[model samples]
Target: MRLIPNMISSLPSSLLRRAAFVVLIFGGLAACQKNDASAGQVTGTLNDAAQAAGQKLDQAASYVGQQVDATKATAQQNLDSASAPSINIDPAALASSAQANLQNAASTANAQLGKAASITGQGLEAAGRKLQAWSAQNATSSASSSASSSGSSSASADSSDAQKQMDK
Candidate 1:
């Protein structure tokens, strides 16, 4: 009991406040459970609450660590810049390099576009030939069917005429 108070006093004020808040919340929940819950149920709820609080504290610590690291890096960069020598840049050379890169990209893009167009045209030509062949086949089949139907109708007319002559 004495050690616990000493440890709590050693913690920063902000951390102590946060710890007190977590305790108050879980304590209220435990009090509420004591009214309608078994001892085991209250214990389980406390366990879960403790675990959640621990996870939240861990996350807060990790975030603070990351912020500290970022601040340190920025400070280092500022110090380095203060002591580093100035750099000389040639604008003309930079412009020439940029222009060369742009031209190369444009040439590569044009070549790819040309290849795509050629492939598309070839695909269209093949599709057109297939369509033409299918149309010709359908036309020939329809014409033969029409001729066979006409021949069958003429034979039926001849058979009717022969039946009429026999009745006379």
Candidate 2:
């Protein structure tokens, strides 16, 4: 009779305790899931500093460009003021020097040609003497051969007559 009411009251209290525990556990898990923004904040600040440094670098490049233009203009002015030296050559002297060199070369060539001609003449005389000696040698050998052939035929005729008289 009293057990039913007491059991129903205890049920509500138990449900309430479980809901509170679930809420605490979900809150802990949610806290773990959330991202830490401190590192991102630091990196964002560094990116901004880098962009600022790039702007300064661009300004410095502009200053360098202006200085380069100034240097170029000054160099052009110096080139305009400076002059190259001019020289005038004497035509007669140039021609006489060239003529003297040509005369020396021609004399050297003429002397060499005369020496070569003298050597060629000596070579021709020696070759002529050698050819005449060879011709004389050949003529003497041919005359001796003809005389020996005539003597050999006469001896053969005398031997044949002596043999016929013996046979008779």
Candidate 3:
């Protein structure tokens, strides 16, 4: 401390004023440099936050794309299932079965018609025989009744003639 005072006392007033001015300028420059460093740190933090936001957006976009792809695939699968082809139809066999059924039905109907015709023929023959027998019976009964009536009428005539003779 004694040396510092002795050096100050020996320095000229003009030189001391120049040295103080130099120290003040250096201190101001250091403060400005510190402020610049803080600004650089703030800028770096903002850049980091922006990068994080960009990354999140990218992730969201990727997730949406995946969902779209999944939905599209499911729709395609549903369409495929709906439009699936049937492989069990056999046209030739179906036609043959139908023809066979028709033939059987036609044969059954023909047989039934023939039976009906035979029964009808038998019924007509029986009716004709019955009618002939009934007609013959009626004819015989009418002939006998007419003969009896004629005989009675002749007897009545003879009685009337005898009565007339007696009266006379």
Which digits, one per residue and each the tens of the lDDT, describe model 1 over residues 43-99?
664565556555555554444444344434544454455465694445455344434
Lowest summed lDDT across 10 adjacent residues in model 2 is found at 29-38
**What lDDT tens digits, residue by residue, belong to model 2 across residues 1-168?**
233234324433443353345335433433332222344543553344334433433443344344344434543443444333464545455444434433443344344334433443344344335534544454445445654777866555644543343233
Cand. 3 Cα-lDDT = 0.42
For model 2, state the Cα shift of residue 66 in Å: 60
- Compared with the true structure, all predictions reach lDDT values of 0.46, 0.42, 0.42
Candidate 3 Cα RMSD (Å): 63.5
Which candidate tops lDDT?
Answer: 1
Q: What TM-score number comes out for model 2?
A: 0.37
1 versus 2: better TM-score goes to: 1
* Residue ranges of candidate 3 with Cα displaced over 4 Å: 1-87, 151-168
Error of 1 at 5 (Å): 64
Q: Residue 162 lDDT in model 3?
A: 38
Model 3 lDDT per residue over 86-121, tens place? 545344553444344434433443443344334433
Q: Taking the candidates one at a time, how many backbone clashes does each contain?
A: 0, 0, 0
Q: Which segments of model 2 are wrong by more than 4 Å?
A: 1-88, 151-168
